[model samples]
Target: MSLSPRFYDLLMKGSFFFVGGLAGSMYATHHHHDNLKILKQDLNILHPPTREFGHAEEKVEVSKDLAVRDVLKYGNPGPIADALARKAYVAAYDRRLRHSAWTAEHLTAASIARPPTTDTSGPVDRGKSKFIEDEDLPIPFRARLADYFKSGYDRGHMVPAADAKSSQEAMDETFLLSNIAPQVGDGFNRHYWAYLEDWCRRLTGNFADVYVFTVPLYLPRLGTDWEMACVIGSPPNVSVVLASKPSSPLTPDVLELSAGAFVLPNAAIPDTAPMESFVMPIEAVEHAAGIQLFSKAVKAAAKPICATTKCELIIRKFDDAQKKPNLRRAVSGLV
Candidate 1:
């Protein structure tokens, strides 16, 4: 109460300094918490929540490797195991079919570019590479080019060579016989199938990422008990039937094994075709390829998007699609 002037001044200054420091701390703490709240909101958008599957309501863990956007778009149907994860994609190879039951790839704008062009320069010497049997197979069934020689079908690729053009090694990996299917060489492989591959590449220009799922379908049809001989090479009728009918339905059996390809753009599709056109039901792919494509949780979300049969693939030349097998030409041709 009876303090000197200097002491009183010093006391007032110290009080002011103390209050200022407390206010500063409070502001910093409040700002920090606000920033954290915003971050949590963004993460929920990016990572979503774990979803349940089936009537069992089992909660499966989302793979740490996949982003939520990828799961939502691609519907990672697990082959129920037996997936061989390689440099570019994952495949479940079926030796009986001499091709992949199905193959899945997540292509990003970042990954598809050679020099990252909107347009790709198809590989220069890719034709020089030959289809070799996948050494990775446990019991090697030689799906040699010679096997298909004069057999009457083109060695169609489950994962087209154009998609693997990101690198030479990636392109070479695609050549393994395990990845090839006997497709109608003239119409399906060279024409419509190739167009689909081109469509997939063009997707990168519009969206940052695109997911592609492909399977060789042996769709059943009428008047073509003949297709069994040509496609499966069994019943001793394959050569005989191909000789007689150069064009027939791509047959699996009386039971339909339709080829299914689903392309899911992570963002909006930039094409004139409606999204339903590219939507392929997981059930169709599963029935045809005999492999589970996505996890149960992924399937539940993707089913609605895939619930359509009107596809964008336009097959103009049905007659030429089924081609005659050239045995002599097999020695020097690339599928």
Candidate 2:
């Protein structure tokens, strides 16, 4: 189905953030009582002074001390994300969701190239890679192999395995549960999503540097109250943004950046569906996912990626080319 007019309008506005390089490094620390007091002060700005008609306004200070102190007595219950760096990509894993909040990868001709035969290790092989839990994460917060067992979803890679063809270790890193989410197997992940991924990789040919961010989003349905659903799995929607710097310089010292954002449902999509139909505003994606993807200056200066290059997806009959494997049998061994 096509997106609503409102979504189309947002796309036309033509401004969105493209986090210049990779996501910033994040550090975790123990929360102290002093920090809680500072947080209370910052939160108090939400309180507005009360006033009556035609009377002097009364200034009231809301005492947030008790609430803040009680809430943080144990420590800040955070919406915490674990920053992870792999051989091929960088990602932030959401502990609550048990999947990556987003993954960033820098793709260049050399980065995605197959390894030389002279290397000690053989070229990266997808057949040899296995889906494994990220041991770096706490056991309680990791996405378990059992979660997708008979769950009717694919253990989809946020950073495509093909993007990490440079090394066997890099390809294996993409199989980590932290970099995966529940995706519809047939028409979506195996078909259309794969096509979109190939398109991003192809950008390396035209641009000197290609950066892609994969984000899992939960957008509300239009014209209805936003209802939350609890599923056996994690995030339901995916948004991917591709930003590229042109190979040739526009000026001796400058190279222009161009980017495009696309959001797709975690369901089967028809091959006939135009890739352009999924075009989304970068602002819309940032607001929906609660993450700033780019700075104002970068957004203002970036040219619409589709304008600089063709945004069409090449149809590859992946399903026809390969037989569907039984999800249960495949993952049962991993357990």
Candidate 3:
């Protein structure tokens, strides 16, 4: 038996109203919530204020009475939103760092490699860099950096490959020119790299978000070519810099701490030109690299080394024993 025309019309009208109401309710719950808006919410800048550069506003406006909701914007913002949010965050913290008693240890590494020009206009457009993509570093240091990243070096990445390998989008992001650096043998690569990746992931889940970038080829020895790499992302909260001394071509001394090294960026972000203030965080970076670049100094007291004849002989012997793995086929540029 078919329903009467009048009854059918009434049923259709009720269903339409119900669907419309549900849609309207959701829209109001998140988008229209006043507290979620930027203007209404309480903004905290962890870093100290910088007299040189003042604060900038987050344009997302919020109302006084609306309720707040925990919303995650992973894919929603895509890359643009991610960039902007990071910029805003950096602007806040950097100002804070300048004001607080917190002192930043500056680091600079110099290498003179002919740059590879990259054309920005087209697929093959990046201009040929004046310096080579890979620097032909001084003999002593070239052997040293190579030794740092030999087969046993493990191809460790400061910006982890796994994080980028999770998907095509992630993988492509990893390939970005800014997020790369060459490292030594697999020992540190396998163990140390994984530790850092896991640590960053943990920080993301704990902190609202994390912005990171890894600089490649920090060949700071004098007489090497000039090379510079910087990322376009928003600044990070914390920064870690790992450094080592090239004692010999085979065996190098990995310092427990290097004062002037790259920033292990878990939080702090870099913006000022290279000449400006330097940034490095000991704790967060310690977590990222899993190696204390420096040994502990208790009560600001420095430890005295005995430098005895026997001890010195043993140290030299160990350095001499370190084997240099051949990469003649892998790297053709080197003789």
**Which candidate comes out best when scored by lDDT?**
2
What are the clash counts of all predictions, listed in order? Answer: 10, 2, 66
Clashes of 2: 2
User: Candidate 2, 81: how far from true, in Å?
Assistant: 0.6
Query: What tens-digit string does per-residue lDDT give for candidate 2 at 57-114?
Result: 2346756799887877898777789999999999999998798888999999899999
lDDT of each: 0.43, 0.63, 0.24
Tens digits of per-residue lDDT, candidate 3, 292-316, equal 3344352123111111100010000
Q: What is the TM-score (0 to 1) of candidate 1?
A: 0.48
lDDT of 1 by residue, 228-270 (tens): 2112321100000000111225642322112233422111111
Q: Candidate 2: lDDT of 284?
A: 53
Better of 1 and 2 by lDDT: 2
* Alpha-carbon RMSD of each model: 30.9, 14.9, 27.9
- TM-score, cand. 2 vs. native: 0.71
Off-target runs (Cα >4 Å) in candidate 2 are 1-73, 221-236, 246-252, 318-335
Model 2: how far is 262 from its true place, Å? 0.2
> TM-score-based ranking, best first?
2, 1, 3
* Residue 122 Cα positional deviation in candidate 3, in Å, after optimal superposition: 30
